[model samples]
Structure formats: structure tokens, C-alpha cells
Target chain A: AQSVTQPDIHITVSEGASLELRCNYSYGATPYLFWYVQSPGQGLQLLLKYFSGDTLVQGIKGFEAEFKRSQSSFNLRKPSVHWSDAAEYFCAVGVWGGSQGNLIFGKGTKLSVKP
Target chain B: DVKVTQSSRYLVKRTGEKVFLECVQDMDHENMFWYRQDPGLGLRLIYFSYDVKMKEKGDIPEGYSVSREKKERFSLILESASTNQTSMYLCASSLNLVQGETQYFGPGTRLLVL
Candidate 1:
């Protein structure tokens, strides 16, 4: 069985400040990773994904995530966060070569951007 | 743009009542999924269908049933709704396994059972 762990339940950062959300996963084989964001009363939107290749993968909305196999982690980061970036972020792990398998997701981290 | 739509945004029902939630995808995706979301529990898959008329039980599919007669439409059914089933239900669709399995989600249906 695979599982995802997001250590931070909530994070607050000032506008224009760097942000990092931690995510760790337990999987046996090469892992497929993804980041998703959801605003209040809205469906989740994909932020980024990592199958294989470069450790650092860029995503939509000026967000990026780095996959560290040694640490069993895929951390989402942004050099600077805008006020609009405040939302709930989730890290998910896909099973079976990213095939038609269920995704295991973290509890999610709520991000708040301070002015 | 890929679009996934759910039948309802909010639903209130009584315990032991039968419930049906519909999901449709306009992108012709072959894979559809149903998930329940709670405050502390992010998303737990209830059921998924890789092809029309073929369904698979997910991690938490105890009281849920699903139908996918058409490729674009998937339905999740509760035999008898309970208080524990009160949660936000999300629908998602994705391309076939050959394509990267990045799912696009619907707005979600918030179901409350009294």
C-alpha cells in the first residue's frame, strides 16, 4: 500500500515571500507524484506532476515541486506567493505506472498569504 | 479544456435513504473515479471505472455502488445513506493509461445525511 504525508496542516506566509510545503510518501517502486490545489468550494486543480526525469518539475501558476527519492519526499515550492495563491494544497501518489489506479492523497495543507 | 461536471453541488438527505450522484465528462476520458473528501481526510477513493460497464472497488467502497454504462458518464449510488456518508463527493476523469494519468476533477457534490 502507498500513502502520502503532509506534515504541515496550515502555513501562513506574507505576500512576496518564499513558500515550501512538505510532502512525504511511502511507496515501493518508482513513485509518480502530483500536486493539486483547491480553493474554497471549488474542485481540485492540478499544479504539477513528476513521473521521471529532472528532480525539479515546474507547474502551473508559478509553482514548482522537487522530487527527492532519497528522502521519499516531493515538496512544493514557490519563490514568491501572491495573495491569490492562498488555498488548500494536496500531494498525491499514483499507483501502477500512473495507470488507471486510485491516487493516495495527503490530508492537505491550507495556505494563507498575509498582506 | 477538459470538463468534468457533477449532478449536484449540494444535497441533503435522510439516513437510510437511497442516493444517486451523477458525473459527466466532456473530454471522452476512459477512466472515471469517485472520491469522498472530509475535513481531516483529504480524498478517499470509493470506486473507479477504467472502461464503460467495468467498475473496480477502491479503498473505501463498502456501502457504495457505481455504474458506468457510457464512457462519458459515471454514477455513484449509496444503497442506504448514513451519517458517516455525509461528505464532499468528487468526480474525476482521465485519459487512458497510455496517456499520463492526470485526472481532471468536477466541482464536487456536498452530501449531508441527517
Candidate 2:
């Protein structure tokens, strides 16, 4: 079965600090990975995606993710954290062939920014 | 922008009552999916529809039924709502599996069964 793991359930960082949320996926072949952000009581918003090509992929809100095949991980990173960036982050893996666009999401990591 | 809208933001229903959650997408997407979101558990697919009147069971299809009579609308039905079914329900749409791998999501509907 395909699965996504987000190791940190909750992570707190100071404002203006750097942020990196770990994500690993369980899949056989080359995988399509994505990162999403969700605010309280709101749906998820796409952060970044890694389909193919360069290991590093950039997304909206000044977010980026890197796909590393050897580790089977696609981690999301941001240069500087902002108060507005505090939210729950999800890492998802996109299926191919049968359910090409279907996604398997991680439990999520809640990020709290300190003032 | 591709917009996916849910019928309600929050719903409260009594146990044994029939529940219907509606979803609509404006992008004329070919695939529509329904998922349940839990705290510890990630989003679990309940059901999906590829076309009008066509549906498929997802990972967690038990205790739920779906109807897709129209192209852009998909509805999830619970024959008898139960207390354990209280959770947030999310709807998503995509053009297709291969062409559109990224799915657009709706705000979600929080269902609380009493």
C-alpha cells in the first residue's frame, strides 16, 4: 500500500526563522509528490509539487520542496517563517496509471510561530 | 480560477438521520472525489465519480453512498448517520488522472452527528 509519512506532528519555530518540514513516501517507482497548507477551518492550499526534472521545486507563498529518490523523501522548506505561515502542513503522494491523479496524504504537521 | 464548492460549511444531524453532502465544481472536471478528514488520520477517500451516473468505491466507502447524476455535481449520502461519522468531509475535482494530476479542493463540510 502507498503511504506518506510526516514525522513531526507538531513543530514550533520563532518568527523570521527558517522552516523545514520532513516528508517521506512509500512507493515503488518514481513518485509525484506535493505539499499543501491548511489554515484553521479552511481547506488545503497547494504549496509545491515535484513531478519530474529538477530535484528542487518551487511553489506559492515562497515555499519550496525537494524530491530525493535515494531517501524516498520530498521535504518542504521555507527560507523565512512568517506569522501567517503558521498552519497545518500535509505531504501527499500522487498515484499514477490506474488512479493517476489520486493522492495519499500524510497525517499533517502543525506549525506554530512564536512572536 | 478553478472553483470547487461544498453545499454547507457545517452540518449537524441526529443519529439514524439521512445525510446528504453536496459538491460542485466549475471546471468541468472529469473526476470528482469525496474524502473524510480526521485528526490523527489523513484524508481518506470515500468515493469518486468519473462521469455522470458512474462511481467507484474508494479506500473508505463503507457506511456511505454516492450519487453523480450531473457532470459537475457529486453528492455523498449516509443512509443513517452515526456518532462515529462526525468529521470533516472534503471534495475535490481533477480533469483526469494523467492530464491533471493535481486536484483542486473545496473548503470542506464539517458534519457533527448527535
Candidate 3:
């Protein structure tokens, strides 16, 4: 079965430090990938997506993710972290097909930025 | 900008009561979906519709049902609300596969059943 995994359940880093959240997926074929962020008491917002073409995709809030087919990974990264950036991030894989297009989401990784 | 709106941001209901959660999107998307979100489980699809009046079961659809009488509206119904059904319900909309669907989510309704 196709599934997504976010190994890190939670990560804490000092403000202004670099951040990376790992995501791995298991699928039979090349799949559509996405990153989303959800702040406390809020819905998820799309951070970036990888459908085709350029392996590196940039998304809102100065976020970027690179899709590596060989590694079966799409990791999200940011150069510097902000206190406001503390939120839960999710990695999802699209079940790309005809009319049954839906997403398989990872458990989620919660980031907490320290002062 | 695409806007998805849920009827209630927070709801409290008694157990065994029938519950209705309404969602509407203004983007005129061809597909709409209802999902339940828990603390550690991320999001699980309860149901989805590719077109008006067309519905399909999703990963966890045992305690829920859906309706899509129009293109932009999708409603999630809890047959008889249970304590275990307390969750954040999210609604999303997207285009068809031909258009390369990317879901847009609503603000979400946090339903609390007691």
C-alpha cells in the first residue's frame, strides 16, 4: 500500500537556526508530493508541491522541498527559522489517478522554536 | 484566491445526536472532499465527490456520510454523533484530474461530542 512517513514526531531548534523536516514515501510509481503547514487552531496551508519538471519546488513562507526519486524522499527545508514558524508540518503523497484523486498524509512533525 | 468556508469553527453536541457539518467553496472546483483530522493521525478522508451527486467512500467512512447536491458544496453527516467522533473536520476542493487537482482546505470545524 502507498503511504507517507514523517519520522520525526517533534523537533526543537533555536531561533535563526536552519531547519529540515524529513519525509519518505512508499509507492509503486513516481508520485505527486506536497508539504503543508498547520498552525495552532488553524487549517493546513500548502507549502509546496512536486508534480513534475523541476525537482526543486519553492512554496510560500520561504519554504522549499526537493523531490528525490531514488531516495523516495521529499524533504522540506528553510534557511532560518522564526519563532512564528513554530507549527506542525505534514508530508502528503497524492494518489494521482482519474476520479479518485486524494492524498495520503503522514502522521505530522511538530516544530518548536526556542529563544 | 480560492476560499473554502466551513459552517462552524467550533461545535459542541451531545452524544447520539445527529450532526451536520457544512462546507462551501467559491472556486467552482470539480471535486470536493471531507476529512477527519486527529492529533496523531493527520488527515483521513471520510468521503469525496468528483462531481455533483457523485460520491465515493474513502479510507474511514464507517461512521460518516456525505452529500454534494451542487458543485461547490459538500456536507458531512455523522449518523449518530459519538464521543470517538470528536475531531477536526476539514473540507477541501480541487479541480479534476485532467486539470491537475491540488486541494484547498477550509478553516475546519472542531466538533466536540460529549
Best by DockQ: 2
- Pull out the clashing pairs in model 2: none
Root-mean-square deviation of every model: 1.7, 1.2, 1.3
Error of 3 at A64 (Å): 0.9
Those runs of model 2 whose alpha carbons end farther than 4 Å from true positions after fitting are: A97-101
Candidate 2: tens digits of C-alpha lDDT, residues A1-115: 7889999999999999999999999987678898989898988888888888999999999999998899999999999999999999999998754744578899999999999
TM-score of each: 0.95, 0.97, 0.96
Winner by TM-score: 2
- What lDDT, from 0 to 1, does candidate 2 have? 0.91
Tens-digit lDDT track of model 3 for B1-114: 999999999999999999999999998898898999998898998998889999999889998999899898999999899999999999988876432357899989999999
Native contact fraction (fnat) of model 3: 0.40
lDDT of 2 by residue, B1-114 (tens): 999999999999999999999999999899999999999897899998888999989989999999999999999999999999999999999888663288889999999999
Q: Which candidate is the best by lDDT?
A: 1
Model 2's TM-score against the true structure = 0.97
Interface RMSD, all candidates in order, equals 2.3, 2.0, 2.2
DockQ of each: 0.57, 0.62, 0.55
